[model samples]
Target: MQIIKAVYINEMFKISKKKKICTSLIFLLLSVIVAAIVVYSLNNFAGVSVTGSSEFSVMVLTILSYSLFPLFTAFICIDMFAGEFADHTIKFTLTGPASRLNVFLGKILAIATFIASNLIVVAVLSFLFSLFLNGGISNPLRIIISYIMAFLPIFIFALTVVLISNFSRGTTSAFMFSIFVFLVFVGLSVAFPQIKSFLFTSSFDWYKLILGSYINVGKIFRIFLILLGYGLMLFAAGYYLFEKKDI
Candidate 1:
């Protein structure tokens, strides 16, 4: 436990010392600004009638979370994992007393922490922006539920990126490969409708479970199982590959 904690802290400190976190936050702020403008314009100028703050926030959050979060998380994971290996700084960490397993799990935890924090920040900002644009929150509970459920896809993407990072030889390779996979999934999800439900990317919009008029428990559970299975598989594969690598 202590070893894992040390690795987590070290990873966090290393990331904090870099500009990636700052860059991510800046992007989040820009996204919020852009979303706010669009939402406000649609309501005020375009004469679209929205329910209230919750609906406005949900619209913005859906777009940002579904699109931006995956891309942002992939880059972050690539920098954290593949960048270390590419620069050979991973050797320094591996040389420590902590076992590879502990280090690997710790890194995963660190990535999750970073992503969760960023998502929470964006959710808050989105809600506040909605309040500023609209009068009040229409369905606070539903928006909150949406925020929590959205993290499911973010973590799934993180795991996939980590696997790509571990398998690839360099940061560029990791980033490119991960992005390629992302695009492929997004493309396939749209291009092929029949198998959409089977694709993990299809399940990324799990937030719809809350937004819809009817909540299907069975469908939600199935999506949850699919995501959970994929996450475990990706994490296990990445860990195995990382363990086998001559770090």
Candidate 2:
């Protein structure tokens, strides 16, 4: 299992590299770097100068966990599963020593690795640099918790993209369609905030789960369980389709 997992990870990165996706991955890295720079440079709030560092840190992490990092990752990963079929490698690869479940888990882990690592890097870099944000609590525990909290939303998102990829079978079009579908979903959900709790975006507010103080953490966990259940259902559906699919 370990060896196959390693090979799977290598193959995943190799695919990313060959597709020139690694270059784009720099944006994820750069976002973190930029956040750290912003936090360190303008800790004094520039003009207002009244809002404390905690406020700024919260704002920065919120943006990172919510809009910026997630949307960017969504773009990068929308093709994850479809790309395999696009390249005509799904059969040869999945029927190997790896089980279908392993394949799904492996692909998920690969995507999660990139997302989680980027979040961690951003959190650590921003946390260390946030020291300049005078009132920012340098509590290491909070920072760790913050990074862990960031992963939930990413997992929910990556799985969504992966599941969506099962429909199109081509990386480029699947990716494009996934984004279109996402926009439509967002638009409808926003138009009716009364039912917002049912939308993935509403539940994806992990930054609020940690950075904000109003919501109960238990509710956040419940939302995560819902997302996980959705992810598993998508994976099962995708796997069934793949098992009977003509490649």
Candidate 3:
């Protein structure tokens, strides 16, 4: 397992060095720059007297960092496993001592780690600029917690892509299903709140989820539990299919 993890981690670095990763990072940096400009300019123009925490600003930054950024990451994740198998590199890894189950898990972890790290970078950048533009960090801990919490759904969404990638018979099939799965999730997020749940992401974005105000601890716990459950369920299925695969 350790060797599998190390190899996967090394491969993750190689993937990160790819041109697409550079492009993606550039895109994220641009978003952050634009977001910062908007926040800074708005603060100066509105003359809203820098006083306490800029809850509104925090929320906006959260959306940029967690939601938009993670969505961008998903496009590349779909191609990760599928692309490997498409060119037959996956077979080389599969034939190694590590079971397909480990490969699947490691790949999922690699994706999750990549995304989580990206979110953390956003949080750091957002915090630095936020302090200067907003003039106060009323509760530093709260802002940080909110940023971390905002990425949970995205992490779950990414893992779903990994699972989908495994079941795909070929890269084309994986690509097609990836699109379907991505759209379905986005649609669910958009439509889930209309029926009953106020907790759905459709009702509120990252800003509303975080710095907009204080969410109850109970609600936070529930959200974490639900996401954790969903992530585990998807991973369990991925493992089941992988273990049974002829490869």
Candidate 4:
């Protein structure tokens, strides 16, 4: 436990020093600003009265989750795993007292932490912007729940990226492969609606299941179980590859 904690802190410190972290923040902020601008333009020029703060926040969340969130998650996972392996810097950590499993867990935890922080920032910024524009938010609790629930599917996506990174020999290859797999899954989900519920990609909008007025607990629980299964399997496979790889 202590070893994992130490490695988690060290990984976070390393991530903090990377320019990618700053770039992610800038991208998120720009996304919110762009969304706000679009809303403003639509209301003034197009004569569209978009006056729901909660709705605006949901719009931003949906866009980010489907686009930037997965891209950044892949970037971070590749850098942490594949990049380290390619650069041969992973040897330094492997030589330490901590076991490979501990190191892997720590890095995974760090990535999860950074992603959660990014989501929180996006939620806060979008909410504040919407509040300023629309005067007040309706159903703040639902918006909050939507953002919170988003983390689960995103984290599961991270696990998939981690597994991909383990199979990659370099950062570039890892990133390319991750994106290809992501697109493939998305395409598959669209091509075959029957199997959509089983795909992790379909769960990206899992939050919406709760957002609707109906609130089907059975469906939500089923999806949650699917995500949990994917996460566990991916984590185990990633760790197995990492353990066997020559660092």
Runs of candidate 4 exceeding 4 Å displacement: 49-54
After superposition on all C-alphas, the RMSD of every candidate to the true structure, in Å, is 1.7, 3.3, 3.5, 1.3
Residue 82 Cα positional deviation in candidate 2, in Å, after optimal superposition: 1.5
| Model 2 steric clash pairs | none
Rank by TM-score, descending?
A: 4, 1, 3, 2
Q: State how far residue 57 of model 3 sits from its true place (Å).
A: 6.3
Off by over 4 Å in 2: 2-7, 12-21, 33-45, 49-57, 66-68, 75-79, 135-140, 210-215
lDDT of 1 by residue, 1-247 (tens): 9999999999889878878788888988898898788767878898876534247667766787667788778877888788988888999999999999999998899888888888788878988887788767877888888888878778988999999998898988888898888889878989998878777777766887867779888988888888889989999999998898886
Whole-model lDDT values for every prediction = 0.83, 0.64, 0.65, 0.90
In terms of lDDT, the best-performing candidate is: 4
Residues 44-109, candidate 4: write the lDDT tens digits. 799886644337888888889999999999899999999999999999899999999999999999
Question: Regarding TM-score, does 1 or 2 come out ahead?
Answer: 1
- Checking candidate 3 for backbone clashes, the offending pairs are 59-207
lDDT value for model 4: 0.90
Candidate 4 residue pairs in clash (backbone atoms < 3 Å): none
Among the numbered candidates, top TM-score falls to 4
